[model samples]
Target: MKKLISMIAVAALLITGCAKELKVTTAENLKVEYGEELDNTKLFNAKESDENVKVDKVEGFDAKKMGEQEITVTFTDDNKDKEEKLKITVEDTKKPVIELKKESVGITAGDKLELKDNIKSVKDPVDGDLKYSDKTVEKDGYYIDKGKLDTKKAGTYEVKVIAADKNGNKTEKSFKVNVKKKETAKKPNGTGNSNTSNNGGSSSSNPSNTGNSGSNTGSSSGGSNNSSNSNGGLSNNGGGQKPVNPAPHQHSITVTGYPDVVYSNMWFEDDTEAMYWASNYEGPNGDWAGFGYSSDQCSCGMWSPYFFNVTTWE
Candidate 1:
């Protein structure tokens, strides 16, 4: 009777051991992906006891902290207490961003123009103060429609932008910079500066000019472009090389050979004779002894039409 009783107790203990060794499955499948984040603590497993009893919470088992779901399940008489560790990794697959900015305006050729911009598009893939260049006339992205246009020259300038993403994915956008000749500067009074100068044929405000009787043509105003400099800025005033044109050595008359037009612009007969060809200069009074040009449109020694040059008079 004593031996039978002892055997019954041992059988009960063995059954309990087998129940605790049952393997448990996680409530949800372990998942890993790029650009995704998960809680390290709540990831857990689901299972049943040997009697098929469902488990709610294990007394001291934790599923979150190991940076992934990791747990060891021990097997009993039914198995060799096998244990395994599971991992849920998050992958990195996001790319970076890029951008550009500048002012807006129309452009023309034969007219000096300037292009300028500050590259400031931001993104995680690249460093700050990002650098980019382009030729598109549009406002943003890789293309810049604005730039310094050399009005004297005509053609299309290709605008391109090259940049890299966080994963080193290279991107480039291109646009066209067209340059063509525009209309000449209009004369004053909406008539254009071609036919008249300041004071309307009376004032030679611009010294180099004489009298423009034929018609005032070919002059510019308000047409400008940014200058090409270290900082990339707009350039309105012209800053370049001169054509090496020299001043005339002697003065010659071109009024169909006015014989009285002397080399010194004097009649030479006398101060009174000087008055004869006085009309050759400018002013309605026909004064010649003035030594200085009266006709605001003072032609060059080579007979080249004198435009408007304020520096020539003084």
Candidate 2:
């Protein structure tokens, strides 16, 4: 009876040593972004200690949408079934928020415009600032419609600024722009400063040229000095002809996008005189002195407001 008992104990030991082993090690809760594909191997650390062990099947998971899902991993060891389960969370259901602050602005006909200036901020609950750039104007994105103003013609127009977030959330606003007609200068009459050496229109020492009726002449002293002054004045006169761009006039001129720049309240002689765009010179304070401008609208740097409330003499 002692020998038989020893043999049985030895057999039990052998049986225990031959038993198959299987294990599944993974976190209880896993997280993933919305719409991301799910992989089984990456989902869990599963393995069988015995060479004959195999994965039988896996079930109880649907990651198609945003929600919590349960995954069951099943395996077989020597024809014996074993199972384990884990929880997966599909998050990212929050949408981005955008606010349009400066929804509208009025600019001159020839001025450049930026639609994004309308946006106060672009924010998201999950991902902060979106760093939105011009690329946001592409398809499934946003854009500005510079409608009807003709940009070259003076009149009232409706400009539409639109935007969209990464999750397809969208918003838009409209601005009414009033482009007033450009001001033009007129020819002076022979009544006032046209008199030669005297206040009246008569002088032989320096005969007044009646080429154009109201020519102004505060004849600068000294011949060469006079010539230089005359040349400068002529160049600015829109065409070598004296201009009577006198003013107690008010203009609501605004400059945007370019900073530390300069622009002028020019007095064009005619519509065709628009060629004098290069004549933009800085004015003194209380005028257009420290305004901003960019020769090319497409590449203009920063954005800021430059309001011109001009009051000019002759």
Q: Judged by TM-score, which candidate is best?
A: 2
The CA lDDT of each predicted structure is 0.38, 0.52
| Location of the lowest summed lDDT over 10 successive residues in candidate 2 | 296-305
Residue-pair clash count for candidate 1: 42
lDDT of 2 by residue, 114-141 (tens): 6567667666544456565454354235
TM-score of every candidate relative to the true structure = 0.29, 0.33
Poorly placed runs, candidate 2 (over 4 Å): 1-21, 46-57, 76-81, 93-314
Candidate 2 Cα RMSD (Å): 15.9
Q: What C-alpha RMSD separates each model from the true structure?
A: 27.8, 15.9
Tell me the tens digit of each residue's lDDT in model 1 across 211-237: 563344433344543223332232223
> Which residue window of length 10 is worst by lDDT in model 1?
303-312
Total backbone collisions for each predicted model? 42, 3
